[model samples]
Target: MLHSKSILSFVLVLFISGCSSVVLPIDERALINDIKAKYQGEILAPEDLKKGDITTYSFPPVWGFNVRSYFSRDGSFSLDREFYRFKNEDRGSTIFEHFIESEGDIEKTGRQIILKNRIAYRKYDSSSDLNYLSTFKECEFKLGTCTYKSASGKDKKVKTYFENGVWTSEYEGFRNSKLIETKIYHKSGLLIFSSYKGLIRGNTSYSNREAFEANSL
Candidate 1:
């Protein structure tokens, strides 16, 4: 049940994955590793870019890959202006992800993923739309943390972990902050997985500490 756009994406991924000289091979692990090496520090000023810092990084591809940095120094990524935000290269620019520290507190422990569909998935399907000018649906997380859900029927809360610039068990789904019925991943700098909810519809294997691949979902 892949959408037309999703199908096209699949084909493109196949093409890139099949290419031998594509540098990073259309997968998540390589991209995550690249991102981890680049921004893993603290933010000194408004323009300072640090690893884990929520700054925008542009890539040299047609479907440009972008990043919004974060780290343990800044605390966590959130929907607030001072936390995190990101964008994709739909306007012929490589400015894919953007981040900023807001004046709010993140009380959870999962990663905030800013997706191309402009959705933020926290845990349990808590997806929401981005505001475009100041608040988009996509974002990034460094060692950042946020509020998440635990297993409960009426009232339950649990702390997800976002340390070392990666979400240990967070899964990105649609526009809901609720964890999807599907599995998610820190796939790459620009991609994520909806495996847990049966989106990919294939059995996958982990790649590095970030990405994964499956022949069936």
Candidate 2:
């Protein structure tokens, strides 16, 4: 009963959103195992995902919620991606703006698939998190654990990214649970914005995050 409820909820998210927002895991087998344990279902094998048989594919490098791969029975895949963004603040908006897509297979070092898409979004539309702007700040964050000291004279344990060396971004009262209230900060750490979010969902790394981090140094 619990398993059925979980599957139903996942389906309801697809139905309500009218689109897939789920990210694909790099280890397809782990996803397969998770399905078996959680909902007792399975997805197509990497090579077995054929056109029409699959609508979601996430290959290494090209991996994301982005539509990818049309595997044929002979065990080859095709690349044809065209991700678009909202236009004019409308739902089911056809005033879509064309953005960058893959130029070649996922392994090319020169490929700008991730970078170009980011630029398009940053230009024509505003960045949702403005994560790129963190570069200009006094300090920046990476994945690590840290303690947050609150003004109330309390210490909270958090896997907080960094205050990297700044003070404002720390969690005020972090408790270990699925949802965590996040405190956002300006480049100078003067501005403060706070919001409630599910930590599991917010933990998603953007497509270009790895490359950006490498180049940040």
Candidate 3:
């Protein structure tokens, strides 16, 4: 009876361990692809656009915007294409005054409105806690532990030992109350890399890593 109990207990321990978040080293290329897939995509402009000035595309689990504009036979916008302001108060006399610098036409690629007020923005449903701004003012170089709240309000803590602005080692999701996420930044405050590990619906669990390079706009 004692031997049987020991075997059963060992099996139970293994099962529970398998169900938990797993952190592993990642490849650079794989990390970049995941970052682009998760973050690089359509972004909305005129964030404060009124409900009426714009038309919304609504679908379960997704939403997008389409401002009314005139088009030519070639599918290019014509001179008739005009946009309205939120109200009679024109902060300044300008229509799409913001410049969108991209290799291709931003409107066609669905990546319009680059560098709002000079700060780059990426689209990720605004759901993932992996936002670019979220990591700001949180910590700095050297060795220490920092705690943050996950999208689901769970305590996510990351401990890092850094040398020369590089994360050498990390203790991610150190406890049950912790969700694992890691971030690295260049000296310029640009996000360089990130990783997240947590549980999801349908018994799915994953550890995702992302690496970002500064893109000139």
Candidates in order have lDDT scores of 0.28, 0.26, 0.30
lDDT of 1 by residue, 1-217 (tens): 1111111011112212111211211344444454455433421221221344333443322221122221213323211221222324443222323223234332322334343322233322235443322111222332234333323322332223443444433443333233311112332233332211112212122112122121121
| Top-scoring candidate (lDDT) | 3
- Best of the candidates, TM-score: 3
2 versus 3: better TM-score goes to: 3
Q: Give the TM-score of candidate 1.
A: 0.24
Ranking by lDDT: 3, 1, 2
Identify the runs in model 3 with alpha carbons over 4 angstroms from their true place.
1-132, 135-137, 140-142, 146-158, 163-177, 200-217
Cα lDDT tens digits, model 2, 30-147, are 3223433442222212122123232221112112213323222232323243332223322221222333445743322221221211111123343433222221121223234554
Expressed as tens digits, the lDDT of each residue in 104-214 for candidate 3 is 333222222212221223333324232334432243222467666655666655565643223432333334433334444422222334444343332323232222221
Which regions of candidate 2 deviate over 4 angstroms? Answer: 1-29, 32-121, 125-141, 145-217
Q: Candidate 3: how large is its RMSD? A: 20.1
**Clashing pairs in model 2, backbone N/Cα/C closer than 3 A:** none
